[model samples]
Target: MKVGVVTFPGSLDDGDARRAVRLAGAEPVALWHADADLRGVDAVVLPGGFSYGDYLRCGAIASFAPVMGEVVAGAQRGLPVLGICNGFQVLCESHLLPGALVRNDHQKFVCTDQRLRVESTATAWTSAFEAGAEITVPLKNGEGGFVADAETLDRLEGEGRVVFRYLGANPNGSLRDIAGIANERGNVVGLMPHPEHAVEAGYGPGTDGLGLFASVLGAGLAAVGA
Candidate 1:
């Protein structure tokens, strides 16, 4: 399998994402923000960073990048896509996922090894994790609070789209302690944590984050089998 890791200006974790893909037994393709081509990759990952200096909003400017157009269309066509940290913000700004991430309730940047409960394994990126399993990964962000209207939140909960929930205390005051979520079709996923940072043994966290990449490799890009 070939997974594309997009590198926008100021993107910090693209290389880590590629390494995670390689560790998961897949080829990692390098993609640039100004380029629209996906290089025939089976899946795509938008890694974390302060894109466009987080101007306008965390991910607002990056959402308009040329590559995102292809990413959005591919996601709609059932291609698996994972967005981490700032990438999550971009996903929401692009409307590929519902809800928005805002400034932390405590009004400060946060970085920690966060515990997350796997809520759903239906998404292509999360199939390797067992339902209700808890795993730890690094989470760092200033505006990581996830918020949505009551109806949307209810729908997400009812439909099992909530993929991961924060364990222990809330990190950034995310609604209902949500740490990650999948799209309605289960192809696209957006989360604030840095799973790529946890893929190696002697790393930020443990190797728990490797499951996400492994899940996509096992299921391919379509979420139907995942």
Candidate 2:
């Protein structure tokens, strides 16, 4: 499987995301923000970082990049797309996923090893995890809070779209402690935590996040076979 990792100006975690993909037994394809192509990769990853210096909004500018056009279209076509941190912001901005990520309730940038519970493992990006499992990964951001209207929250809960939930304590004040969410089709996912940073043993928070990449690769390969 080939997973494309997009790099926008000021993107910090694109290299880490690519390494994680390679460690997951898949080929990592480098994609540029100004490019209109996807390089024929099977899945896509929007890594974390302060894109465009987080001007105006976290992902507001990055969402308008040339590459995002293809990403939005690919996601609509059932191609798996995982967005982490600022990537999550971009996904929300692009409407590939719902809800908005705002400033942390503490009004400060937060960084720590966050504990998260696997709320729904049905999504392509999270299928490798067991429901209700707790895993720790790195979390860092200034505007990582997730918010949505009551109706949208209700729909997400009722539809089982909530993928991960904060455990122990809410790090960013996300509504209902929602750490991650998946689209209705389960093909697109957006999360604030840095799973790619936790894919390796010594370098990452732990090996707990390797499953995310594995899950997507497995799902993509299975879909092709089916």
Candidate 3:
């Protein structure tokens, strides 16, 4: 299986995402933000970074990038897509997912090993994790607070779209302690945490993040075998 990691201007974790994919036993393909094609990868990951310098509103500008056009279309077609940190902002900006990420309630950048509870294993990126499992991963961002209207928040919770929730304390004041969420189809997932940074042992928090990459790769293999 092959997973495509997108690299946008100022992207910092594309390499880490690719490495995570390779570590999960799948081929990693580099995707440029300016490109119009997806290279036919089995799944796609939007790595964390300040795309386009985060000029307009976090991921506001990068949402209009040429490559995102294809990503949006592909995601709508049931292609698995994972967005981490800044990439999560991009997903929201592109309207592929709902809600928005705002400045942290503390109004400062935060970086730490965050504990997250897997609320739902229905998404492509989270299927390997057991429901209600707790995992620690690195999270770093300035505007990582997730916000949505009451209806939207209620809908997300009611529909089981809330994928990951903060375990101990709310790191960024995200509503309902939501660390991650998925689309209606459970194919597109966006999270404020950096799972890629935790995929390797003796590196980050631990290898807990590997489950996300493994989930998608295993799903791709199953599809092919089917």
- The candidate with the higher TM-score, 1 or 2, is 2
Q: Name the runs in model 3 displaced over 4 angstroms.
A: none
lDDT for residue 79 in candidate 3, whole number 0-100: 92
Off by over 4 Å in 1: 221-226
As a TM-score, model 3 comes out at: 0.99
Q: Which lDDT tens digits does candidate 3 get at residues 1-109? A: 9899999999999999999999999999999999999999889999999999999899999899899999999999999999999999999999999999999999999
For each candidate in turn, the TM-score is 0.97, 0.98, 0.99
lDDT for each of the candidates? Answer: 0.94, 0.95, 0.95
- Residue 96 in candidate 1 has what lDDT? 96
Clashing residue pairs in all predictions, respectively, total 0, 0, 0
Candidate 3 has which clashing residue pairs, if any? Answer: none
Clashing pairs in 2: none
lDDT of 1 by residue, 1-226 (tens): 8999999999999999999999999999999999999999999999999999999999999999999999999999989999999999999999999999999999999999999999999999989989999999999999999999999999999999999999999989999999999999999999999989999898777899999999999888343365
Candidate 3: worst-modelled 10 consecutive residues by lDDT: 217-226
